[model samples]
Target chain A: MSKEFFTIGALLYKDYDLIDVNATLRLLGSLKDNFNIITITQTGEHVKSYTPQVANYINYNFENCPDFDILFIPGGIGTKYELENPVFLDFIKERAPRVKYVLTVCTGSGLVAKTGLLDGKKATTNKQFWDWMTSNGPNVLWVKKARWVVDGKFYTSSGVSAGMDMALGFISDVFGREAADEIAITAEYEWHDNPHWDPFAERIFGKNI
Target chain B: MSKEFFTIGALLYKDYDLIDVNATLRLLGSLKDNFNIITITQTGEHVKSYTPQVANYINYNFENCPDFDILFIPGGIGTKYELENPVFLDFIKERAPRVKYVLTVCTGSGLVAKTGLLDGKKATTNKQFWDWMTSNGPNVLWVKKARWVVDGKFYTSSGVSAGMDMALGFISDVFGREAADEIAITAEYEWHDNPHWDPFAERIFGKNI
Candidate 1:
């Protein structure tokens, strides 16, 4: 209702990779004037991360989430477990169509794929856990040689640190290249702008799919 | 004292930059088998970050802090306020000399410089806030062209995300380049092994110092 800043719903769960989650948050939050992020979870209670860092509280729960322009899902070791959760899958099923953009980092793409949202889309997941991640979405056109993949409204990135690069890319798409460049410059990050500049994929898989 | 993993005391306070703090934690935590991290704060209370993310609890207070091999300090807008706090400065002054390594990310280097440990020692800080960050330590040799700077046991990085690079550099120095490379490969990160590859310094200042 308030057209102030673009609202982003950052979904968090137990054992979520803290780096992937926080890197995306920090980059998006840096553009606070252009974006307002709310940490969302299945429950509003404390969420513990794979790093064992505990967040005292989350902003919203699944039952009472607000309307958001974008949905940000980050991956962790927990993704293997979360993918099998019916409630989590249902939440993605319900919300994926509502949001204008769907952004997934690391194996978070695997969770999105499980909802069948990424079935016909070009997406990517963390290269480190290539086999486990790729095994989930048989119908998805998985990009093996990408730092990130962009297909329509979906943006999926490679791994833990790659999420920052994808967030910058999303910023460039939504705002402008200049805005994204400024954010990266401010953070002192070398934005690997080329989506296909993924050496990890080649190193691990021996080829870029 | 356990000779197993290197112990790092991660200093925390209100409004500390979540990106800087978490990036360092996630990278270091990935090597948990080789490093034991404890979040230290002024009080044992939950410290809220600039992102408003609350850390559930802190490990130790300043007075009761244990001996650590390395001291980790992160920076945020809170750095502007924390710089003037005598207790914070005193804590740094006391612990810095005792620790084998002092790691400062973003404006955290400015805090370290304030304690005079970095006086006459070469270091760096967040490049976006270059002037203000460098203004504090007149005697410190500041490297304007660096993703991260290493002078003796002190490792200081450029900005929020540059901390990740510095952490990898630290990992390389401590555990060997192979170990750092393995960690980077595992996280699927392009480890910018060369510290001088700082495009931000050149873009912002028109030259690398």
Candidate 2:
């Protein structure tokens, strides 16, 4: 509607991981005029992060949130409660299929998994909570040694800050490698462009687990 | 205080850089129990980020903000106006001397420079806005080839995400390298440990410039 900007709906809940949410959005927001990022919460108010006592002001409730091209879900300790929420799951289940892209950071995949959207989908999540997340979707093809896994419109990534790298990769996918590289360079961030360049899997899950 | 947590006073204005503020805080916040981060705004209400329309709820105002162990300043388009505001400059000038560490990301160094806090000290700023930031600090010695510059308590980093590397370096300085490494691994982020490992200098500004 406004220019040709793609609307990105960023869902928030109590105790949501701050870094997981911001890191990804920073890259997307870098293309400012090309993207419109909005904060979505159940109450359409403010929600505190998992730690450090940071809060984000929400712009929309699930019922009133405008149609978005991309749907973003970030994971945190609050996700333990959110995963069981029928309203949360139902909202995602109903909206995700209609979105152009659905992205989940960290254990956010588990939230999507609970909605049955990630069933039979290839995905990867925060390695720290690997067992819990993988078990949530028994039918989903879980890849361990991946920074992120992209299957069709569903893009799932590893832990908190890993979302930034995955966002850059997503940018590379939709835009070009040059555009992604330019953003990373402008931000003075090193782009781990290779999706297979994950050392945390073996380091966290042990040699063979 | 509650436990042995170090307090961080984060200054916010109308259009502060979001990534520059959040990236460093994410790393420091990872060690949640050890640090207490507080947002300080002009009116103790909320501040918007320079981006795709985002905002942050504030914790304290300039008049009520408590003593902090570390003082953090981030740059943005709003900084163009903040540089001339005496209240902003006066607060930083007064508090910076008593703080254990003063970290400035990107053109945030320009704000500190205007306060004369960084005068005759080694500092760095965003490569893209190098000329503008350096011009603000006539007496400050600016380094071109640095991911970050640490001259005493002042940690002035290159740009947005370079603040994360500086934060890790600060962690290694305060805690230990092992602790910083552990945090990095947990976040699934690659830490650029070396303070002088900045390729952006040569990239943004050609060699022999």
Candidate 3:
């Protein structure tokens, strides 16, 4: 609300889930006047996603990255590898508190959790990797039955396509419900508007899908 | 079935729908042993999506593109510009018939329609642009009620997110219903199981979604 347009710094790494970044960010980027999006890779000029192997063009390296209003963290098979990375962890530690909102998709919570940023906050991640989710944030309250969890400025989604739904929630919070619905309708997406009901979680916990 | 792996030659132009290509193909690409996906652009080393400005690394250009088992076509604001390009049209005309299956997403039907291969085939495209769909292929049996149409070897989806549903249908056709369902579950996607009932189409035609 303070800025004319929110600047989003999307931190991506090798083997990141393709849909997690694109589908979610695509919706946020739809509101051109309200958001400015950019991609940042730790040290590489480019990064390749885990499966189907799509290459992404990196906007800025970590060293020269611009300050952003929102920090967009995407989960991947790759984030686990960067857990102990001093520069990566340092970057999150430094920037997470300054940003107005921190939106994470899937294993992105894993990264932020490792930084001890979500120590007492509620979060969630890819239900398929429930063990990975639990292991990442020992001190954090991890909700297993939600499509996404929002505790203060941090929002974490379940997995893959759930990111898009979470992004819509963000849009609804920043923009309006009408704006979110219009986007979901335009995308032709069957938006799971409810953040609490997660079929993946239910199925994982031996309940009916 | 003859080959060890099904090679997918994805034809993408500038400003091609990001989610249409990534979301649909990402699932296909998930079955690593069954699929071999590659990007084919129209004379560019890299192509950018319409919004969120994601850049795609092109594998091969039109002149020296490789032949594959399936031909993937994605629609965007950019496809309309290539309607008359001989090489693009020729690529479709040549490969479409030779391939086992030809899958098109959103406005991709518009590009393929111009090539005249879909003249007598039952096709569907993005319902948002009804005029563009109708104008591109007058002779084609354009279905306004379906999310996706499968006529012979040609498969055309209604619009952006509909592509993911159509791709799952393709998986079910090639693999099995169980295989498609598993992928949908893994992606954590809210799969629209029934393609015959397209709410987007109905909504566009003045019905409730």
Candidate 4:
């Protein structure tokens, strides 16, 4: 492994979407030779997901976390509750700005939106809960028809499976399109290459915003 | 939930493919009202994935396991080692015959193929490792171009992300298209309705087998 490999810190909390978290990890972990991945939680304890699946232990807590080049956050039914958590918001506020990439999946955008970093930026969230998600960051220009939105360093994706698409895009941005396409082929994933070709957003919002 | 709700026992082992496992869990879990999901391992301990993510704890071990309506087996790099373990093979042999549905994702088809359940039946596996996967169950007619295959009670998907597509197909088979389509709509997933339209298989093996 190279000494300069990128580090990605994934946020973990109770009720975090298991699919969003795992899919992103699987994609990034496949590039393990180039990335050092760590799972971080509020307290570094075992967290229970909405599926009721328990994740054994997190790698770090806010107080002892290392600097990361990327921050990955996943959204779930728990985001509705985590939004009110000052510790969670504080952690995001502190770490997001320092990371080269701030990636969010599903309603995870809602939590990231609370950090104020998304203010005045273009972003998107899980379309199934669009109205509620949009309300979180009123100042942000939310793209209604995007598999994912990339503005500066922030990458926000729509819904659960869409996270995989966003991660592929992120890989393309970081490693080049050929690398991303190669990874997609190895995983046999039909990469939704265009960020704006989201049918879910079209179905939910009536028009692609 | 109904008294007769189907129970899906998902096999969890060290280095299991987290994406394949979690994607299926998320889709079926969304239908939790109609299913009871449980995670099982060899010794019922917390299992670490190839990505080094920790699953808190499994529900049952081989000795005290419950009869399942469906058995979900996810594949990973660990499978290369697990295929040689007699205990793992015996466990699958004991549980698979009694289950109403047997679901295998990615190289998981390789593991299920070892059970001999797929012998004389048509199935598919991860296309990137096609030659190696095909060698596992030579007598089984392997489909080269398939998002998923359904041979009676068995459902085998092409690769990692393809598992999500196969699970949707399984849902459609068991709960009508309306139910499956509704779930797909909620997840904002473009369910590849036709299993035969697998471009990966076409690209790799030439023509749909």
Candidate 5:
């Protein structure tokens, strides 16, 4: 039997690039077979893809969204616009309780944090705008030194690739270390004992210290 | 003046799932200003946001695409079919010479290898198919231990998130380490100084030693 999963992207249609956005979708979809994943968008349009599976689009117009075992919110520059939209925030707030996992990549955490669900919860963002993220959602424990953070029901990653780690991390948490290990092995990831830090970073930042 | 940069995806039809594809594209687009990136599809269709960028949708079916400074190809199950197409192989061979860089994510490396570009070069792929990757492309050094591998002009990364690393790695190679460092810092990734390797692989197959 295949496990069911859904990943919702908060695409606001502002100057966002297509590479990273598409990258996140592809990585999450890698979980297919074991998990049936679909895309959620706010514009209520059918997403066209050269590959149709990647085009399985869902519209979120403040009224309907399929029940997702895992609700993912990927970030973009438009996240700034999303943060201020109450309808989107309200939609997230309503669904927050139903999902087994609440995940965010890059600045997507900022949008969910705005819903007040992450208040007092440890979270993270792209780090380029940590100050802005903290100011936007002051109630959560903002972890600065992290590639991704896991606190209770919320799993937030630092930036683009971190989202993949967050997805793998969630799979590990729910299915067991073996599943995560297989995925990582298949993906050729080093599988950081801790996804939070690495020596290359120390080489770069250690200098400042 | 803004730098003239663009990203291209091998838009194979009817395979990839929207969740991972769109999320990756969206997040990558958010990095446009940083990379000075614009994106065009294989059919010469420019992509705008999560939708196609070109209006005419002229479908300029070039025998081989015109030159660009950077070219990126993403993989899905469809890549297996793509591997058998000689036209795609010729197309990659024709366009590769003119581009400043060639990059791929996941199994998309199969396409790159099919072009014979990485025959004797060091490379990697989605972990599950490392053996197939090695068999398909002879003399290709299997850096089975790396999440991503950079062999001179040819750069290949392990499945999924490794693409993010490849993108950032390509940016660093072209723009300089400083630019890559800034991007890594902004993204909050440590730059996995050592490519991701499974510690157990060495021990599990100790006889190879």
Candidate 6:
């Protein structure tokens, strides 16, 4: 059988901080040879931006994102709003079985928790909001100290900036460490250096008592 | 004769906030039909996680950026550090004359102002840092109230997220408002609701006070 490689679907909605949405889109776009990716908004519109090769975007209702090799969820300030929606959660639960990979970044892990996908599974989110995830899904093993975490098919990552690290890790899993390393080198990012607790965060929040 | 189009360059750095970079990339990427989009990075190596399809990523050197139709500078914490480099400023001064369209967002505008490119031009930066911008670029006409400002070939925007709005406006200038609107609509960005402020500056900061 053919490898049947395919595009990744990034589900988006209102208050979906355009930065995270676009970051994932651009990262996935860079890996075009290995994965076809597009952004699907709540209105079922395939959003197009500066990328023309990505002109023919595929749009879908939040609850109707199509079957794809990977389902990516980027986090933002409005993540709490998504967790409160049963329609969105139900769709996530329904599609969990079809996607080979389920990825969540920043507060996006909360959505997976709402779907019960992370029950008794290891996960992570913005350290500032870990309590919210813990409160919503008590059974999940919350790794607050991690930049990214993996449990079964579910992959979760810390805050907005860490999304790139999580995505690179996913790309590493799918394509190999070398490919991931290549991308990190191109961006001048320390491929594996993830200081989960930023010094600024510690300064602002006061290092865990 | 084909319409004179310019390639806009955005510098992508490691650990840079993914979303901020994406907002600008998406807008520039979408305008490829009318503009050539080139991304210059401090590293020519592989960039994992975020948007990594930088047309030409250079490594640790200011000399690698190509002469473009336009120069786009997106802001983030990266700007905080990049702005401190004198070599980078020299590179900007050397290239500013070759390109007619010079644009920046958030702290990135500070770097532009530092190069004295916007010395006499009207511009803006993140609202929280308006005073800092004025202090840094004493001669520039700092418009603390505008979301995005266009003065001659110099364009600057306020804050990180606002880069997309500036990019859309820039696209409209080159591709017509209709094409820009179509791209925004497909992206589901509400097309008309920009989260930038100009009048708010006068009200909040008191234009004269």
Superposition error at A62 for model 3 (Å): 1.5
Off by over 4 Å in 2: A1-4, A205-209, B1-4, B206-209
Candidate 2 lDDT over residue span A1-209, tens digit each: 12456889999999898778877898888888789889999878788886687777688998889999999999888899988888988889888988999999998999998887888889999898899988889989899988888999999999888889899998888877888998999888888888887889989767775
lDDT of 4 by residue, A95-155 (tens): 8878888999999999988778899999999988988988989999998888999999999
| Count: clashes, candidate 1 | 0
Query: Which runs in model 6 stand beyond 4 Å of their true positions?
Result: A1-20, A23-209, B43-61, B192-209
- DockQ each: 0.53, 0.73, 0.65, 0.56, 0.23, 0.12
Candidates 3 and 6, the one with greater lDDT: 3
What is candidate 2's local distance difference test score? 0.86
The full ranking of all candidates by DockQ, starting with the best, is 2, 3, 4, 1, 5, 6
lDDT per residue for candidate 1 within B96-136, as digits (tens), equals 88988899999999998887889999998888888999988
Best by DockQ: 2
- Local accuracy of candidate 4 as per-residue lDDT tens digits, B13-90: 788877888877777767766777778888887677877443444778877888888899998888887789889888
Candidate 3 segments whose C-alpha is farther than 4 A from its true place: A1-4, A207-209, B1-4, B206-209
Higher-ranked by TM-score: 1 or 5: 1
Score candidate 4 by TM-score against the native: 0.93
TM-scores vs. true structure, each candidate: 0.91, 0.94, 0.94, 0.93, 0.72, 0.51
Candidate 1 Cα errors over 4 Å, as ranges: A1-4, A52-57, A207-209, B1-4, B44-47, B52-67
Worst 10 residues of 6 chain A by lDDT: A48-57
lDDT of 6 by residue, A1-209 (tens): 12446567777654454445555455544464667664566666533322432221234676565567778787765577778888777777877778888888777788888777888899877656657766777878887566678888888876654665676777777677777766654333334435353432343346782
The Cα local distance difference test for each model comes to 0.83, 0.86, 0.84, 0.83, 0.58, 0.63
Please give, as one word, the docking class of candidate 1. Answer: medium
TM-score of chain A of each: 0.94, 0.95, 0.95, 0.94, 0.77, 0.81
Residue range A84-134, candidate 1, lDDT tens digits: 899988988898899889999999999998888899889999988888888
Please write out the lDDT profile of model 3 over residues B1-209, one tens digit for every residue. 31347888889887788788888888777676788788888785687787655766678888888779899998877877788688888989888989988999999998889888899889999888878767988999898888889999899998888998998888888888888899899888877878787888788786643
lDDT of 5 by residue, B101-205 (tens): 666666767778877788778887766665665666776776766657887766777665566566556665565667766766655454643455434335334
